[model samples]
Target: MDAEQQYHTVLAIAGFDGSGGAGIPADIKTISALGCYATSVLTALPVQNTLGVQALHAIPPEVVVKQLDALLTDIPPQAIKMGMVHTKAIVSALTKRLEAHTKVSLVLDPVMVSSSGHQLMEKSAIQAMITKLFPLTHILTPNLDEASLLAKMPIKTIDDMLQAGQKIKDLGCQSVLLKGGHLKGNTLTTIYFASDGQQHTYSFPKIETPNAHGTGCTLSSAIAAYLARGENELSAITKAQHYVYQALLQGKDVAIGKGKGPLNHFFDPEKTIKRKAESGKQGN
Candidate 1:
């Protein structure tokens, strides 16, 4: 593709989910759905299935740093999305790289907990994320469970989500997308906490499915991809949610694994690629 039409690439620094539901695979799918390329740097390897994560082994901190440096040295992405950092060492390694390279857009998905009742990051790692990475993030996307963990308080209601959103903003992020998925209800709400002190609430009718494994990863990556393609932050998030909703709707029936299956990231009802290629060949 020509430079004008070349796909923008997003660097995803996260873990590997063998389940393909979350982590690096989900990030790649989300980026592709938005018509962007994705480059990955895996920090951990998780033995997971549709049911849940079975085991995890974190990559060495120095190895993770080496991956980041290799990518940055050759070709820096238009955006960066962070997922699972299993230790304070990994967090520090990431922070050092970020400090060295100050000219990148970063979307931090503070994944402290897993869907199957497991803590992914140690207390020191969580603290390092708050101290080192939060300030540099263009946007931070954390679910209610994550928000509560960070806030050191329970988030049981919409009011709590609102409060947590502001508190997250106080942690130095330019904006926060507080997802309200863990709260019990038929409706799901997400709040956007802007650095300008403006807050906006987005609500969607919750789809009842046990297979919603990679929603957070997908959402954050989608936001990053859109931003890389020149969309404003708010606009990027809004569009990303729309894309996610459609993917969920498409994957509701297709079961790939025994546990919670992933949403179909590529659900192009129209064959846009084929049509574009034909048009290009015909000099249209």
Candidate 2:
């Protein structure tokens, strides 16, 4: 490989799922699939699968800080995605490290609950996330359930989603994307609220399938990858959501586990790479 030939890079700081359904593995897969190189820092080691998370063990704050420090000093990332921050200590470390390097676009996917109804984060961590983590985030991606929790209300309708977006934004993030997958409807809508008072709505046909695990993780990582590839924020998000929609459509009914399985992150990444390469050539 030529030393001058460089690809976009996204640094994912998330938990590790032993089953490879979500967390760091899923983030890596999503980033790579979106035509970017992926690097990672582990926040926790969770024994999890499609069925659900079994256990969680968070990495120490000091270790997490060290990893960020080394990465920032060396090959710094253009975009960063964070998932499954299980402790307040880890949240603090993330905030501090990000404060030092404010150029990288940061996506925070608040992974608060498990698929099986287990709490994935502590109450203290929730407070810390809002206080310490939110202000540093470029985008706060939250699914319906998470939006409901953070917004302190039920999100059963589009109006509720709008309300929730405002509430989440009040937490101090630069923007909020409230995913409407959990709403009871044939159409899935994702609402975006930017700090500039601009709001955008994206709608796609809902894919009814059991193989939808890690959708949040995949979506956030994809957005980061797109951003790293030099796309505008809204364009990056729109492209990423379309990628997830396509991945879900391709992987529907594909059974890899007993319960809700993971998305086919390996569906097709080459097309993305080729398209990007052609676009670059045209630019020159």
Candidate 3:
């Protein structure tokens, strides 16, 4: 193997959704579509579909740690994306392993609830995630509901989103991306707040569609892929937002399930990116 030629790899630690609409499946699709090699560690197995999650079976904390150890030791990822940690034990396990690799950018999608209003995380895990995982996260991507839970307030407008984003950022993450898709309006606005006193606002017309399942997973994975390819946080997030927007627009009418369908993750896939292993830089 030539050190000069390597794949830009991203690791996704998340739950397994057999529906292929969310969780590990969505992460793999999104990362691969964005031109990165995706590796995953299944944290939980959720009996779910486009409709909603029925039940969840969590992987043991020790098993999860072993998986992390195997991957982090050999195919070390350039970036990591985490979603749907269901328990405090899993959070503690992940935190212990992640402490050694602080250099790797981590994009965390705090998935607390499913699109169909099913709780995906335990209430106790919320506090653990905030105390243990937030400081290690490079960027925290939380939708309106999750943000409301984290900030302990409702987000009904862009102003509320800004306030909520700031509040979440104060909890220790380097930055927060508060998604406003749930707000009642024709337009959706997402705000990004950084600890450095920088903020970015992204607003676009909402594409009315039921095929929006796994959007949060896709968006966060895309951000990790971009980061693996060496983009800055803001650039990676901006590109990822555009990718999700296009995916939603393209898959608006395509139906895959009885309930909400999934976005076409491979609508326009890119070739796997190559980079130099020794230099830790992207290569054409």
Candidate 4:
């Protein structure tokens, strides 16, 4: 096949955030920045801003299924990033689609709550999500709150994190990128566990910033984008984490809205080359 014909595509199954802080916008930004084409499916329409979510409207399961099927028929994605699925019906539809399209790699961002402390998914949808989609996931990215919810226990200490990692793996995901943002300390740690039973941890010096939003969405989408580009799961996760951290560190000084603003998704030079070329051509 020609090189252009072999272009990698990433599908993002997530909600719509008009503010671009989280959901499909963040997923598309992260994937595009990481050198992949992004396709999106909106699961929820939320009234939100940088401060928080005000209300949400879940898209019907039939509509969700139709959109997914249309994408599968026309543009087959190499990897999928799932975020903010608001209902069990949506989860059921997605699982059915995944069953039909089992070849695609999946990166799951279990987005239960927004960074500004807004609940995205319903309490009832949790178990359905765990049973239906967790096993199909190639990598599950969850913050401390999400991890604790999924683990059904408090994840406060290092030992608790490890135990939760193990338990999460046993729940059927191929790997877990357990985020530690909610843990208190001078440093932040994220744990990665592969299906092969190997565990690795990445830690970063905590930067004092309240403007970090969509970090989880960005990380998971970056991982999916890299995986679509043929990187292994562990390699993809490491690079994605570094990408997100740097994006956060760079955007720490900039201001966007009243609440938590977005990270600098364009922090990588190599990743921005294609975009710059396109813009330069457009300017001509």
Q: Which candidate's TM-score is highest? A: 3
Per-residue lDDT of model 2, residues 1-284, tens digit only: 33434567789999997777788999998988877888899988888777887887778999998988887776677799999898888888788779976788999999999878878899899999999988889999999989988999998899999988998999899999889998887999999997698999999989889998889999999999999888988998999999999999999979887888889898888433322232232211
Q: Give the TM-score of candidate 3.
A: 0.97
lDDT of 4 by residue, 108-131 (tens): 998888766778888878888999
TM-score against truth, every candidate: 0.92, 0.93, 0.97, 0.92
The clash number for model 1 is: 3
RMSD of 4: 5.0
Q: How many backbone clashes does candidate 3 have?
A: 0
Off by over 4 Å in 2: 271-284
lDDT of 3 by residue, 1-284 (tens): 56678898999999998899899999999999999999999999999887888988889999999999988877889999999898999999999999999999999999999888888899999999999999999999999999999999988988888888989999999999888999998998998896577999999999999999999999999999999998999999999999999999999999898998999999999998777665654331
Error of 1 at 110 (Å): 0.8
| lDDT preference between candidates 2 and 3, better one | 3
Arrange candidates by lDDT, highest first: which order? 3, 2, 4, 1
Model 3 whole-model lDDT (C-alpha atoms): 0.92
Better of 1 and 4 by TM-score: 4
Off-target runs (Cα >4 Å) in candidate 1 are: 1-5, 269-284
lDDT of 3 at 283: 35
Query: lDDT values of the candidates?
Result: 0.84, 0.86, 0.92, 0.85
Ranking by TM-score: 3, 2, 4, 1
Worst 10-residue lDDT window, candidate 1? 270-279
Model 2 residue 180 lDDT?
93
